[model samples]
Target: MSKPKVIVIGAGIMGLATAWQLAKKGANVTVLEQSAVPNPVGSSVDDHRLIRYPYGDKPGFVAMVRQAFGAWDEMWADLGERHYHESGTLVFGGPNTPRAKVQADVLATQGIDVEWLSPAQLVRDYPLLMLDDLDGGFRLPTGGTLRCGRIVAALYRHLTFQGMDIRPFTQVKDVDPVTASVTLADGSKLTADKIVIAAGAWLTKLLPDMASRVTPSRQIVIYVRPPAGTADAWRKMPCLLDIDGGNNGFYLVPPTPGTGLKIGDHIFSRQGDPSAERIVAKAEAQAILDKCAGRFRNHGDYRIIEGKACFYTVEPDEKLLIEARDKALILSPCSGHGFKFGSIVGTRAADVVMGAADAEQVRRWATGEAP
Candidate 1:
C-alpha cells in the first residue's frame, strides 16, 4: 500500500512538528520552508522557550500542559537525546496580589505540589530579586525550559534520516485549500493528498481571508548577563512569571547550563510585517528593561547580550486556532503562549490529518473549549 502524501508549509516548530508526526505514521511527508528549517527568527528557535503550568484564568492549558510533557518525553525517546532542562518555575506578584496565589491553588487542585511563598519568603529565597511591595509567589517543579533550537535542529536531523523531503527557501505564493495544492513563488505548483498550513506569523500572508482573525505579533526578547555579585543567584534562578499585573509582566527563563537569561513579555505587539526586517530597535529593548527595572537587583550592571525581534500569529482571545477547510487544515497554534504545547499539538494535528479524529473536536480542544 502506498503511504498517504502530505505537504506542510512553514518549517517553524508547529510546521515541523506536524510533519514529524505524519512521517512517523507512515506518510510520505514534504516540508516547504520559506527560509531554512528551524528558521532563526522563527518563534520556536531560541536559546530557551518556557513550559509552565500556571495559566491564571486559562484552566484548559493546565490540562494540556500535562499532556505536553508526555508528548515531549515521547519525542526525547525517539531522538535519543533529552533537549529539556527542568530546573523549576516561579510565579511572583506584587503587594496585595491574589492572581499568583490563585495560580498556585489551581495547580494544587490538580494534585501538583505547589509551594506558596510570602513577600518575606521571596526576599529570603531569591535575594537577587528586588522584593519591595511584593506579596505572593509560588514554586512548582513541573515547569521549566525547553531548549527550542536544539530540539528543532534534532528534529530536522531525525526527519532527514527518515528520508523526508524538506525544501528550504521554497516560498509558497498561494494555497488552494479546495485542491490541497500550493503554488510556489517561482510559479510551480504541487498537489498533495492532504495539505497542512502550520505557517506561523505568515499565515495571513498566505491565507489573506484569515487577516481579520489572526495577526502577526512582533515580540521582543532580550538576553542579559547578570553582574558578578548576582551570577550565583542567577545560576539557581527558575523560570519566572513576573506578575505585577501590568504590560511589563514578562516571563523569564533562567540562565541554566548552556543557556542565557531570557526575558520577554506576554503582551502582544499586535502588528509587524514578518517579511520585513526583524531588527530590534534600541528603544524597544530598553522599554522591556525599563518595565523590569527595580525588579532585579544590580539591574544597571546587567549586560545586554542580544535584543531580538520575533513574530507569531495571535488571535484576540489568544487560543490555538486549529481548523479545517476541506482537505487543507489550518493549524495556527499561536499567540504568545504556543511554544509550550508544540509537541502534543503536532500529535493532535496528525490525528485530524489521518482521518482518525474529528476536526471540530480538535478545534474546540485547541481553543481550550470542551473537546
Candidate 2:
C-alpha cells in the first residue's frame, strides 16, 4: 500500500513542523511556500520568542505550556542542537494586580515550583528594573527564550535532508478544502490525500469565513542596546512582563546569547493588511520608543537598534483555531503567542490526519477546552 500523501501550505514554523511530523509517520510530505523558506514577512521569522509557564488569567494555557515544552525537547533532540535558553521569567505588578498570583496558583496545581517575592525582594533581586511603585511578583524558573529564526532554518534543512519535498516561491492562488487540492498562481494544480493550511497571517485569505474571528494584528517591537554600565545586568536578566506598570504594560525580552533586548506591548492593534508593506511608520515607531523611556532605566543611554512591524492573526479570545474543515485542516495556531507551541501542534495535526487521534479532542485541546 502506498503511503498517504500530504501537502502543507506556508513554510512558517507551524507549516514546516507539521510537514516534519507527517513525514515522520511515513507520509509523503510536500511543503509549498509563496516566498523563500523562513520568509521575514511571516510571523514566525523573528529572531527570538518568549516561552514560559505563566498564563496570566488563562489557566488552561498553563497546561498547554507543559506539553509545548515537551514537544520542543523532542524537536531539539531530532535537530541535534538545542535552541532554547532557560533564562526564567519575572512577572511584576502591584498588590492589586492579580495576574502574578494567578499564574503561581495555576502552576502550583500542576506541582510546578514557584517563588513569590515582595516589592523589596524584587528590587534587590533585579536591580535593573525601576519597580519602586510595584508591590510584588512571582518567579518561575521553567520559562526561557527560543531562538525562533534559527529553529525554522534548522527545520527546513532537516526536513529536506529527510527527503521531504519543499517548494519555495510558489504562490498558491486558490484552495479546495473539500477536494484537498490547491491551484497555483500560474494555473497549475496539485492534489493530495490531505491538506494542512498553516499560513500564519495569510490564513484568513484562504479561509474567508474566519476573517471575523481571526484578525491580522499589526504589532511592532523595537530592539535596543543597553547602556555601557548596565550590560552585565541586562545580560543576566530574565524575560520580563510588566503587567502592572506604565504604558498599559509591556513585555521585555532580555539580550540573551548576544541578541538585542526586545520590547513590545501585549495589546493587539487588530488591524493591518498582511499583503501591504510592513514598513514601520515614523509616528508609530516613536510611540514604542517613547514607551520604553519610562519603563527601562537609563533609557536615554540605550541605543534604538531597529523597529519591526509584523502581523499576527488574533482571535477575539486569543484561543488557537485548529478545526478540521472538510478534507483540509485549518491550523492558524496564532495570536502572538503561538510560535512557542509550533512542534506540539504539528504532532497533533499529523495524528489527526493519520487516524491516530480524534479531531474533536484536538479541537478541544487547541481551544483550551480539554487540556
User: lDDT tens digits, residues 1-371, model 1?
Assistant: 99989999988778888888998887899999999877988888988888888887666788889989999998999889898888788877732567866676677676677777887888899888887677757788777888999998999999888888999999999999899999999999999999999888888989999999998999899988888867667878888877555677777888888888888966888988988998988888878777778688778887778999988889988889999998899989888888889899999999899988899999999988763
Point out the worst 10-residue segment of candidate 2 by lDDT. 241-250
Q: Which one wins on lDDT?
A: 1
Q: Distance from true position, residue 313, model 2, in Å?
A: 0.3
Clashing pairs in 2: none
Mind sharing the TM-score for model 2? 0.96
lDDT of each: 0.85, 0.84
lDDT of 1 at 115: 77
TM-scores of all predicted structures:
0.96, 0.96
